[model samples]
Structures are given as structure tokens and as C-alpha cells.
Target: MDVIYANSELICSTNASINKCSRYKGQKTLKKEVTVHKWIKVSLIVLSVCLVFAFGGVCTLAILLSHATPLAFFNSDFSVPVSDQDQNATDYKAQFDALRHQHEETLRKLNRLNYSTGCALCAVHWIHSGGKCYYFSKFKMNWTQSRDHCVCLGGHLVIINSKAEQDFVNSNVKVTHWIGLNDLETEGHWVWVNKQPVNDSVEFWIKRENGIREPDNWTKGHPDGEDCAGLGHPGGETDFWSDAFCSLEKRFVCEAPAAV
Candidate 1:
């Protein structure tokens, strides 16, 4: 009878230990699950808040968040890993710059009234982008006339330095607008309003379907040939540039540095 009691006590003790271990493991699992759930909730809230802030015309919140940390925009260190193996970290500076530029441009388009009516960095009726202010003309003028008008407004004809600037102009203009590119001094040698030679790397000339490239110096009427560059020709084509007679009256875009 003593042997039976001793064996029963051993079994009860073993069962009690097993129960304690099981309870501990269950609690541990519950804690891990709760942590994951909380992380997910916070992620959702951050994304929703960013969207709301951006749409409310206060996208500077997004910028501030980006500047907070190198990984604030991507969150690799504290993010929950879905895979057992580690994921490679990527350099997203280029992508982040592009996103920020696009976001600012989108905001300008969304609230043109506020931006155009009054800007701290730009004049009333001018729009700011990439540290520059642009004035899109509402009236038509010859190339020389337009250039002079832009000068009168403390600016020059728009000079496109990069693809981003080219894209910005493309998005803003609806009709064929005269650009800063011209070959007036030396035919076939295009120059910008800043007197800088057009970089072949960034030129956006049109290639004809037959494989012919522009600056063909095709003359419409004048003996000097087409000396001015115009983009988005009406009803003929859009998204490519063509040389036109400088005497032709057309709308133009002016560019100037933003106020300090």
C-alpha cells in the first residue's frame, strides 16, 4: 500500500509539472501573437494617416517622416520578417527622391489655386518646382517676343536640364509651347535660355516613323530654316519636340530661380 501511494504521488507531481509547462508555453505563444497583431495594426494606421495627410494638402508630414530616419520610409530593422531567411536591404535614395518630387508636383496640380495665387518662393501666377518657378503664358507671341517678355518678368525662356524637368513641362502644357532651345546663332547648334548647349544625353527630339531624327533644319518659310524648338504640336503630335520658324507666334513657358 505504501508503494502504491508513492507511485501515485510521483504521477501527480509529473502531471502538475507538465501542466505548468503547457500553461507557460501557451502564454508565451499568446504574447508573440499579440505583438504581431499590434505591429500590423500600427502599420495600417501609419499608412492610412500618411494618405490622409497627403490628401489634406499637408504632404510635408510625409517629408518629415522621411527625414526622421534612413529607414523610416522602409522600416527594415523593426519590421516583421515574413521569411525565415533574411531579406537584402536596398538603397532607395533615388526612388525616394523621385517619389518626393512626384508627390510635390501632384500636390501643386491638386491645389493650383492656392499655390498659383500666392507662394512664398514664387510670384503670384507662377508655379514652383525643383527650386524654380515657371510662368506659362496665356497669350501667343513670337519666339523673340516671348523671350523678351520672360526677361521683362525677371526670368528667361524655360531651360530644360533633365528628364524630370522635361516631364514637368509635358505634364503642365496642353498646347504647343515654345521652349528655350534655339539654333539662331549657329544653325543646327541648339542652345538653352541659360546659353548652355543642349546636352545630347537629355534631348527629347522626335524620331519620325521612317527613322529620321529632328533638327532636320526643315524650313517652313524663312531662309534661316526652323530655328526654334517647339513641343506638343497641336493635332499633329504630342510628346516630341520639333523645330519651328522663330517668327511663328506661340505660347511659351518662362523659368526663374525661386526667391531665397
Candidate 2:
């Protein structure tokens, strides 16, 4: 009976050993599987990171290429050539200069026309001839008073400087008119209202064939004392200027520069 019991105890010990060995093997296999699973997850994470970086790099390169100019890439100096642009700028400048010249020429022509046609610049009822404005007075006044009136009207007494001007005055004046020619400051030294001495270069005094000349200082009471000159009908010619007393009242003509 003792032998049998000893044998049974040994059998139980062997079975327990076998069970412990099986449990150790099962735990090692589970640990190895868990380690392999962890390594696989880490490898997948690294590969995903690599793919994300590669996609980002590709997107950045595309954006840079989209914004870059084609000419900048083609030229070695990286500067745009200015041949066409310079030619266009030169053409524009030439066109502007031509327009400016045309404008200046048009202004010059307008000024010339204004000078040629005096009536274009004169006021109503004012006659324009030889680049001068003339106004014929309707009332009568003395020489000094007439000059003062003309000055008040922004002009002076009519100063006859040429035969054309004299003819114009003769055709316009309906009655005797006081002129600007006078020797009031000095006898026989005639000067215009503008203080210019009367010279033969611009003189328009009428000369008669009968040995008589105009501005003869021909008045009844005063001979040489007749200082003021006037244009009137005196016997033979109707467009002759004669000196008369300064106090005598007569119609007058005023002259001024033509308005531009």
C-alpha cells in the first residue's frame, strides 16, 4: 500500500509540471504576437508621415511654379527687355508734340485773323481799321474838353498817321471833327496826343496844287495862335486838316488800341 501511494504522488507531481510548462509556452506566444503588432503599427505611422511630407512638397512646388513669370525664367538677366516699350513711349511723345504744335499754330492763325479783320475785335458801333479802334462822337465839345472826354472813354483823340487812316476818317466823319495833331506846347512844332512828334515819314497833311498847304493855322481872329488842328471841308478839298482856335467847339473822334 505504501508503494502505491508513493507512485500516485509522483504521478500527480509530473502532471503539475506538465501543466506549468504549457502555461509558460502560451504566455510567451502571446507576448511575441503583441510585440509584432506594435512594430507593424509604428511602421505604418512612419510611412504615413513620409507620404504627407511628399504631398506637401509637391503642392508647394506647384504653387511656386504657377506664380513665376515665364519671361523671368527665360531671360538670363531676369530683366524684361524694353525695346517695344521704349518705341511705344517714343511714339506717344511724338504724337503729343505734334498735337502741341498744331495747337500753337491754330492760336497764331487766330491772332493773325484778328489783326487782319479789325471788325472782328471791335465793340458795337465802334469802327476798327488798321489795327485801331475808332469812336465818332455825336456831341460837340472844345479841343481840350473833347480830349478829356475821349480819355474818360478809355481812349484819346484820333491821331491820323497815314493816308489810308485819313481816308477812313474822311469817309466816316459826317461833320468837322477835332484831331489830336496840335502845336499847343510850341508853335509850328506839331505833336500827336501821345506826345509823338509829327514827321514827314508818317505825315498825312493834304497839299493843294494852288500853293496852299493844310494846317495853315487859318482862323479869322488868330493866325499862328490857332494851335489845335481839325479835319473839315475847307474850300477845295474836303479831307484837309486845318489849325483852329483850341477853344472852338467841334465834334471829335476817339482812338484806342484794338481789343484782342
- Candidate with the greatest TM-score versus the true structure: 1
Q: Give candidate 2 regions above 4 Å deviation.
A: 1-119, 218-220, 233-237
C-alpha positional error of residue 17 in candidate 2 after TM-score superposition, expressed in Å: 99
TM, every model? 0.53, 0.50
**Candidate 2 — number of clashing residue pairs?**
0
User: Tens digits of per-residue lDDT for model 1 on 77-114?
Assistant: 64543232233233365665677576557545645655
Q: List the residue pairs that clash in candidate 1.
A: none
Show the lowest summed lDDT stretch of 10 residues, model 2.
76-85
Q: What total of clashing residue pairs does each candidate reach?
A: 0, 0
lDDT of each: 0.81, 0.81
Which window of ten consecutive residues has the lowest lDDT sum in model 1? 82-91
